[model samples]
Target: MVTEASETNRDAGSVGDVAARIERLPISKWHIKVRIVLGMATFFDAFDALSLAYVLPVLIPLWTFTPAEIGLLISSGFAGQLVGALFFGWLAERFGRRPAVIACILVFSIMSLACAFAWNYSSLFVMRIVQGVGLGGEVPIAMTLINEICATKGRGRFVVLFELVFPIGLVAAALFGWWIVPTMGWQAMFVIGALPGLVCLVLHRFIPESPRWLANKGRRAQAVAALDAIEREVAGAGQTLPEISPMKVGADRHASFKDMFGPIYLRRTLVVWLLWFGTYLCNYSLTAWMPSIYRSIFHLPLEVSLRYSLITSIFGVIGGLACALTVDVFGRRKLFSFALLWSAVALLSLWWTGATSAETVLIGVTVSYLGITVLSNGLYLYTPELYPTRVRALAVSSATGWLRLASIIGPTAVGYIVAAGELKNVFLVFALVAALAGLVVMLFGTETKSRLLEDVSP
Candidate 1:
């Protein structure tokens, strides 16, 4: 077995030897292939995560869903995601990234299928919660694995480019709702989400476990085998791989959850929590309710509401792409902080405008989406960079778990805030949150541009 062979080489290899090998390899077809496969899986993950937003507009009329019930349905998945993120993060650490990811994919896909078969709101809600577990787990593990494999020089671009697929998934969901819900039904969306199950086979067959992760686990041979597989592909393509760097060996320290608050990581951990909480709080608060807001408040037709929401999501994808293009160049701290502040200003503008006209609302949403999407996508790049490989996935997942808490509170608050008929309050509240997030980043965030993961975190 690979594990047995790795045990034999454990004493022969120094710490970070495998990471150095991985970091030194130039980008090649093998890297592109892995990104494509992972990107496809993420596309569906995004699709399933936001599919409920579109589905709810249709379900509201059919099931007579009240605002409170709507909040529960929207938050149920995030509640599951909180559990899944922590559980799967631990599984990634304990078992392996490859197995944990595949398990999460299967769990969500099967539960998504069950969602299609749901006979009532309660049934669908339960399925969404289960599906949320898979949705929550896959992302942090995927980011951690990508971070492990990527070169530092362009790490932000690589990770953010992969994350771009998520907003694309949102756009796809909006389009699906625009076209499908009025004709076929809401259940069809879940059926499409279930198709990602097929991606599980491709992932299992092709995606290698993170060499950094293997090396961290003291499975040196397995780590080398993984790196060698990529090196062989690079070499076969007639490109000479770079020589591995001489890595400084450090004590093999196992990270615990308690270490998250230790001096080295405490401020970083707090900044990330604020970032995740604020970003998702603003994002889901606006997005999860947009379709319904358009239909209920603005008195637009269902098709028009979905289409307007689609336009806002298109802006989000554009913003995410802009961030991916510039994050490495602008640096993580400056770009993230600036984007958050920009979003806060946009939300404040919306609040001042009274959010009275569709034109005013659309413009506000477009600008806010642009900034928030950048922060939303950028957080994935930023979070894992804060921790060493020993606790990378766990820290990222745990930090992101704050997003689930915000998700629950944000949408539920929207229910009450919108219920009060003072929609402007939502903008004011989110604006303050975004402003505070920007301040936190400016005050405490570390710049990770062009630095090796080990150097930045360790």
Candidate 2:
């Protein structure tokens, strides 16, 4: 839907007329409103994703959960997320992003209610798996949709700021869990998470479909209709629409999972998979298990454990904010390489000096969280940019399959490692993974700083 500054691209292949229209539109209040609608979906997705972690402390004692069982329960959601990512990616390409996202929200919110009503461990475990499917699918599809609408010049900060809500959701969960879980019950958190579903009704009314997606599907009239909607919004906000530039293009709507492994995209696909796996492995493991570590290993009060975990999440929000401000200037490639190494160093410090005290462990975890979470925020922006509109949702959602995998592995690994009284090894291993991913990215990653979507991928 955006620009390509490359003179070669200008001559090689046109970005098509619909994409040109999207590229020329100026930023306006309309953009902000659309972001809020989409951002709210991801906000609740984050809350529902982490809801299990906050509830685990209470459930551990309530149900007499072993560490192995704790890991299984945590990993179960991610296991479902993996499936959701692939299926929804296809659904987005086949049906449309709007319907796919709406369906995902419904699936998770309704299942979250079922989770609240779960009477036993087995029932909740199954419910989380179903919920995970929705959780995994919403984000990649949403990111692709946002990228489709965004102009290239400021797209990095625009999308990253929108994605920033994800971390905010984590913060809200931790803070609310600290308060709500102790007073009311853990089930209230799931009930609170279901609130995003209410917004789904009003969503299609506010935001238009991705015109780039429409045109790519060879539905020229629908693409023009969506662009007409966006223009009306911009006009209502007291702005004159600029004239669109010349564009001549051909459709490449046959994009599928196969193209991602072809010569053009294979390296990027591999590097992005590593980034997703390593980043989420480190991130989810720490967030999901830190409260349990504080409660069980350090003998902290339940409230205190949740509060410390909340602080760590706030640090992660700070990391994401820093990314939003600077990713445009410094570029995605350099930032990713540095942040991954930074995460490796922070976590490795804990292993090097002996992770003895709860306070020390919290400090190390917070520092590691700061560096690693930048990838969590920026990858949403970076991943979509790596592919064109034809395959953007498919590639991004499939990449998130790696995130779900890491999420599954990380928590399960923590449960067993902690169970074996070798907690420091957790940091040691995650650090190595981070370092390895950083190296792969530094060597192989392409710089997609301000280029238009068509130029980069096509």
Candidate 3:
């Protein structure tokens, strides 16, 4: 009895130590604040990305754009995203994260407002492409920032929570579009999309530059100052703090993008690149066509279909949070592989539902959406772990840029598929691709759990 009590006390002490360490991580508060801001930014992202989808139901009738022309407008932003990811990733390396992120916000905000003024399909398409650049730039840089600020143990939680903002944005879009598009018009949606960028501009001014980024850039004094401020913030709350050794990260000498593809990173690069392509393809396919798919199959009113979409978005957030809590415990490879396998099964069930009861269809779609949300959150966590500080943003952005290229193709291909009256068969393709993606990940991807951020690699 005495020995057992002693062991229990020791365990309690260890737990206390861990809690204190987590509390002392430089960016704990910053992470929370940034996620709140990211929620708003992601809301705009979803709003702008899907604004056309909402508008399409209204605009197709207004403008008489053929399926092909409508497809072009839908995909134009994705094309811009493809270019923007690469361009901004490169620029982030040169200009630092704070400037790059703010710049992207401004570019997208101004261009989205311009979209509301477009008189014709051609002008709207051009504006969308420009807006995509800003969209692409925002996420990759944000990911880079989050990865740098968060400690390794808290990484999965931080990344997953931040990622959840994206789907919430989509839900807000659906809600806004459902309410406003019918009352005011589709143009009002774009006007609404411009609001968050202004909010971002103001919020960003108060949030200091990332200490980790400063360290990675060899700005030791600034990094130390940032750390001191963080320590003061914690101390002000009357918390005991852990001692954090000051360490410089990244290269003193400038490194090129080619470094990402070198021998040390070759295997990691390949896995992350493929993972981005597969997961993005899955996410875009479902989100882009959700309203249309509901419309065609359920024959419901636009508002009712949108309500179901909003419900799914809610479930998506829940699913993301669940992943955030459990992913670090389970390991990225294991959780993601399971998410993929189940997503494939869910997609197959969705295909099966096309011939079954309405209730079954709803269940299937819900499962698939939930699974994909969990899987994508896993990728967001995994992608940043694969690269070192020197090339982290560039590596993540490179994969995302290519992934955006796939996103462009996924939605447009769906448009073509729908136009051909073969919408029912498309779920099968999604299932197969998801299955293959899982297999690839399971076979080739390295496990990353309980490892330091610097230790995660090919």
Candidate 4:
């Protein structure tokens, strides 16, 4: 295995020796390929995560599910997600990031398709839980890989690039749902959701095992080979090569289950968990219940309401990309705080406009979606960076599990609000949550700007 020790030996040769050998590996091509793989996996993450919302606009009426039952179905995925995150984090530690990620995507994809075939409410609910597990695992693990691979100088760019697709995927799903739900029905929308994952599965084969994992595992030969591959790809177009330093490979890996609770990481764990929980609470509330909210308030046709929802979703994608572009330079802490403040304002505005005309409400909804997306997409970029490579998957998963727990709370709260005709109160409460999330992040979260992945850990 390639350990830090092995790197010293590789560096012992004339500095030129490391440079020549490392230059032989293909870095640019592989980087692009890996980024594509991560993005594609996120596509499934995007689809499965939000697909429930699209269905809610249809399923509630078709099946005559009560508000409480509909809330249950929406949140069931998050419960499964919590389990998947912790388990996959452990599994990634036991096996490897590549295997865990691929397995999670495949499982979720199949289960999402299974949702299409669900014969009753119970069956659908069960499949959603199973599907949630897979959804939970894929993103954090993929993020672990991406964070490990990119240079510290370029890490923010890469992480942002990694997150940009999530909004796009949701927007796509919304557009498709709007088009198909009326004609082909909700079932076909889910079947279509399954297709992207299959494509991702086929593409996933090309993604290599994470070099960081290999180095940590003491697989020196494979680790060196992987690094060499990345170097060569980067050296394309006749760029001058830099010396590569090899790390030692033969020690026992430092990552352990207990490391998650280590003194160095414990505080980080709490902050990230809170951030995930609070942000997700606001996000899922607007998402799972928004279409219905629009329908009730605006009295629009089903298809038209869905179309409005889809347009707002596209703005979210825009917000995500904008945040990604500036996060590193502007700083994660600043962006997160700024986004949260806006999210709070937007949510409150949404509540205030509840009684207004359809046009005014539509504008409020768009602003609300924009704020929430900026808050979420901006902050999630920080989750994997909080821990070292060894425990990164675990840390990220732990945080994500909290997010699922929030999902359980957020939608259930929406049900209560709706039942009591207190949807406006729900928005105000979520706005406060959004503001608190921002405060926690601004005060507690460390700025990862201009630091190597390993450097940021301690």
Tens-digit lDDT track for model 4 on 390-436?
77788888878888899988898788778787666877888788889
Between prediction 2 and prediction 3, which has the larger TM-score?
A: 2
Against the hidden reference, what TM-scores do the models get? Answer: 0.96, 0.96, 0.88, 0.90
The models' CA-based lDDT, in order, is 0.87, 0.89, 0.71, 0.75
Q: Candidate order by TM-score, highest to lowest?
A: 1, 2, 4, 3
Worst 10 residues of 3 by lDDT: 11-20
33-63, model 2: which lDDT tens digit per residue? 8899999999999999998888889999999
Using lDDT as the measure, the top candidate is: 2
What digit string (tens of lDDT, one per residue) describes model 3 on residues 135-200? 888877877777666776677777877887777777778788788888898889898888767766
Q: How many residue pairs clash in all the candidates, one count each?
A: 0, 1, 1, 27
TM-score of structure candidate 3: 0.88
Which lDDT value does model 4 have at 396?
A: 80
Name model 2 segments beyond 4 Å from true.
1-15, 248-253
In terms of lDDT, model 4 sits at 0.75
User: Model 2 clash tally?
Assistant: 1
